[model samples]
Target chain A: MSSERGRGGKARNWLRLFSRKSPPTAPAKGKRDATPDAKEARAAREARRAQANAKKASRPAKTMLATPAADGRHRICVIGSSHMVAYKLAADETTIDPRLFVHFQGLAGREFAAIEADADGIFVDYEKLLLSPRHLRPMWDPLTDAIAYDAFDSFVVVGTLRTSHILKAFYEWRTTGHFSRAYIEAGVEMLIKRDPGVNLGQAIHQASGKPVVTLAAPLTAIAVDVGDQAAMDEAYRETKAAIEKGFHARGLTTVFQPDETVLDASSTKEIYARASQTLAGVEHEDEERAHMNAAFGKLVLPDILAAAGAQQAETGAPRLTSA
Target chain B: MKNPYQSLPERAFWRPSVSEVEPTAISDVYRPKFPVDKSMRVVTQGSCFSQHIGRQFVTRGYQWFEAETPFTHFPAQLSRAYNYGVFSFRTGNIYTPRLLLQWLRWACGRDEAPDEAWTNREGSVDPFRPAIEPDGFASDEEMLASRNGMIARMRESLPSIDLFIFTFGLTEAWENKESGVVYPMCPGTAGGTFDPDKHVFRNYTFLECHRDMTEAVEILRSFNPAMKILFTVSPVPLTATATGEHVLTANTRSKSLLRTLAATLSEEHDFVDYFPSFEFIIQPPFKAMFYDGNLRTVTKEGVAFVMSHFFKAHGAADETDGDDAPRRRTVTEAENDDLVCEEVMLEGAAAR
Candidate 1:
């Protein structure tokens, strides 16, 4: 707290940042950046420059994060299930808050870690984890790096309520051919009640000392289940509405479903759900029909942007006048 | 030994009605005139004291009818704060028999409330139940729509309400002179401006209570003839009285009047039943063991005692070993229950 300037102190910089992980005891006004990406990029750039200087002086680079800047574009962090892949794709495809840089980490939806309450803010240590694809290491590093400095302005969490699950249950006849409209609706309700998104958002907000935005898994039609899509459509819409309301109640933001994501009440357009090839023309992952391609990700980018805008609006809230 | 007194049942006298029996052992105070089981679509609306009945229904597995539930996604506590799904509907505490009748009349389309809403430094409040919304409604139009939604909910739920438990908390109320209707709280307590000329304090009489309650019952039965109404007088004494009498005397008079009216109504009709919750808290032998430090607010033990007898008579309490669980201990139940009373505000102002 002494200075927001250069600190010659070295060894305990990690401890200093770790101490910032304490619960934001009082949520003060104007304490956080309204927009984050640009600031994070600048922070990373500055961090590199400082690390180079530290190397020249034979001091540990960890000292760079010791002195903090009070205001700038935020350092945004995202971590969630497979749905995060689409979010990563969407952010890349779209123009985002110029001030913000998203340091996103992708974890399968089933993984549960009490991140926010942890003294060391790293929810998962990528170095310790063993995965089928080593490529995920790059994704995990940014989240740890962001938390080490207590650098997040906001956090986005995506989870099981994803539309891929919706498409699988309601959109495809192969999986839902025997299900009645009532049964399907009930299934959707069950998924919502059990959806980990809101709880994760709550935990992240509490632990990270940052505003949290929740993204319900996006909706895409399961092309296989053409038998009766009316039920699936109703389920999807109801689930989305429920998820949004739940998030709002907990004081978290929600990314809106992209427009034209659904072709009709019962189905997602084929083009959106088709296996999306990467820029190198390679398939992304398991050949799951429920996942949307990058084109669909482009459509969903606005929702994340909207959520970012909402977070800023609240932090810089205009004192509302009652009529 | 062969005297006439010996011929009477043990339940006929206080010595057996409560004394000589453990406080928790008291039972059969609520013998239903007809069958009422767990499946009954029960509706609960009354004083703050009646919240115990609503909370018990959930633990006991009865389908306590929630006609107007907030969107399912809302966190349970926040939903409760907005007064959604906390009761059978969001009528917020119907403290008087007259207010119940007023609500019944409006619900049945026999009457229409004035296009009235209240506003103050905080925000706009619903004319009937102001504190139901924390910040008050944003606009008079919003308040009106919310009120309409509540009435519509009553209209939909009334047909299925097999049992309606209403506990009267007060006989005193402030009346709108022009409208001739009583309000739950004095205007300025939670919202609106207090005016001496516009607001007149009225202590409702036994006759008015009888007429209003009977009319409310008739209106309810007309919609669904099978609906059985149970009346319980709140044990909590008058927090403060506007009648200019000492508060202790005011408590006695208010509770006695309500008790007599309920007893008379129950005696005259098979559908109407009165439960002696008033006596269980105030009378001797028990020695107000159920009350909190205030000597007015009933404690968890008192609510449990009343409920034990109530459910046992209806043949439900036996299943519950009647453990004194503190699940119902909440900010709303303990401290926030006072929000329902205008007199509490009077006490607050006097304290200041």
Candidate 2:
């Protein structure tokens, strides 16, 4: 019950489950409802887990992951801000896209900094870099390398458009019903070298001539106390898609946050973000409300990896020859 | 017993009106036919100059009625840049009385607006309001949807308007020859390619302007039965003339016709009144100093002087509103200015 309450951000579904179950009658009005048999419930739970694991295993080997098996997997670099946490978790756990190992590069802060690059490859001191908690100071990481150009076949970049800012706009727009065309123009214009993430991604793509796939930022959750999800969902998806359209206009591939993990389209289910905030290797929960965990990555990876695979085929530039 | 000239005030004569007086202190240019209160839901539309009225109404504590409110989080700087709150709605510059009538007719469904949208290699555009969408809409459907949204808001809000201030810009316009669907700007100048067989240039005569305005008022009255309609003529001359006559000659004919019609209409209709903005700003004794180097665009001092005179007579403005006055001069304040004449888009042809 405590665990269920802890992960109850998306509690409506669990409430439905509880309502449908024909549980044994309570002893009295003051007492809690009877628990289902532990052995039976445990067996059923294991069975569901087994089915999910089998389903994940059934997918092709090229699905994106953090650590590549090195035996014949395609390797691609994943670059982002704290938003990259989910990709790392998903890659560490399950099959996301077809068999592709991610050389994930991520960091925190400096959202408006310009990119720096020279002849010896896009500048980064990989040895001094730390891994991805991002809760305290901005930590930099290259999934498993300092990275030269030829290390990966392609790259996936997240944190392009200022999703958090747009999320704030979406909430205010939804609540107030005032939509500014000028704000949209400013946001669209910001998707260039002026923005830190876009600058880095553009610089790296330009240097390597490798196809770059950007991850569209996820919609943030707003507290929903009423039945306004239908309206909010439409606004959420419409806004997200519009932002994606701007990137599409700029000649880049995009991997949008998938639909199923989206609860109310305003934000993802708690199991994906809120529940797994403190996974075994990660530190404190809720250090950032925006970052997602591996659970979300698992649900969203297929769409992302599929987009990447499609881009690779479309832009048939050799993956790594010159570098 | 006294002749009409003997009964008139000293300001009615040229010496007090223009000659030997302080240009700023000469106040008795107009008297209101009906009272205008600061509380009335006043809506403003028409030529580029009308924006000055709308902005002033807002800054001066008038209940400037706006239908198209921007989002809550939309920043003030970007909101100005995006051209929100420039008018009651984002219909861009209406430019002429006929355009206003056409919009009113379309609003009440008294007339069927042309269903076709204009397009080029870039994107689709609303022929009636080409510059409303900066880069143009993604498709005809999108353009129509957006235009329909504006129409819906207009129909919904027009009835609630207590005062409607309109400005007449020009007599010349480019429109669909078959349907008489007039555009704010001619085809090709702003968005579409010009096809001689389809599009025609129209210089509206007095009868046409009067007739259109009459019908437009009837349609508007259907929204708010007792709405007061105030009209003004833009002092800015025509940017470029479509008529083969010299631009100056064309400007004179156009302004004269509009002024004559406004005077006639004010005399005829008890509800209608004309403000002598054009007469006060550009008519001789001031040496046309109100005009910039182009001799077309009105200067900031000119706009300020005109608006000050107007508010003193008919508005409830104060010193605070006067602080941000004369927005016409600087480019920054006018960045999101919708007070543009689409005919100016034809300047290249004259240069060529």
Best by TM-score: 1
Residue-by-residue lDDT tens digits, candidate 2, A1-323: 01111221221211111011122333432211122334465568567656654653453332122233345445666676567666665665553234444555555444213223333344332212322233334343423223445555666677645554565455554554344333454644554325556656666677687776776556554344434665666566657766666666545677667777666656656556674432224553563556677667666665665555533443332121110
Model 2 DockQ reads 0.07
Q: How far is A8's C-alpha from truth in model 1 (Å)?
A: 40
Tens digit per residue, CA lDDT, model 2, B43-149? 88888788777777766678888787654443444444445676687787887678888888888988867778889665787898887655677678767766777
TM-score for chain B considered on its own, for each of the candidates: 0.91, 0.91
Evaluated on chain B only, candidate 2 has a TM-score of 0.91
lDDT of 1 by residue, A1-323 (tens): 11111122222233332222223333322513222634575478567655644543452222222323435655555666666655555555555544454555545423422223244454443222333343333322223322542665666776657555644555432332322233334445555555666666766666566677887766545544544566666555665665666677677878765657676554466677566533223465554555567677666655564465433643441121111
Q: Which stretches of candidate 2 lie over 4 Å from their true place?
A: A1-196, A199-217, A223-260, A264-266, A270-323, B1-9, B35-38, B60-62, B69-90, B174-177, B191-200, B314-339
**Candidate 1 local Cα displacement, residue B102, angstroms:** 1.4
Superposition error at A17 for model 1 (Å)? 13
Give me the runs in candidate 1 sitting further than 4 Å from their true place. Answer: A1-78, A88-104, A110-113, A117-121, A124-147, A150-295, A298-323, B16-18, B27-30, B317-343
Provide TM-scores for the models. Answer: 0.66, 0.63
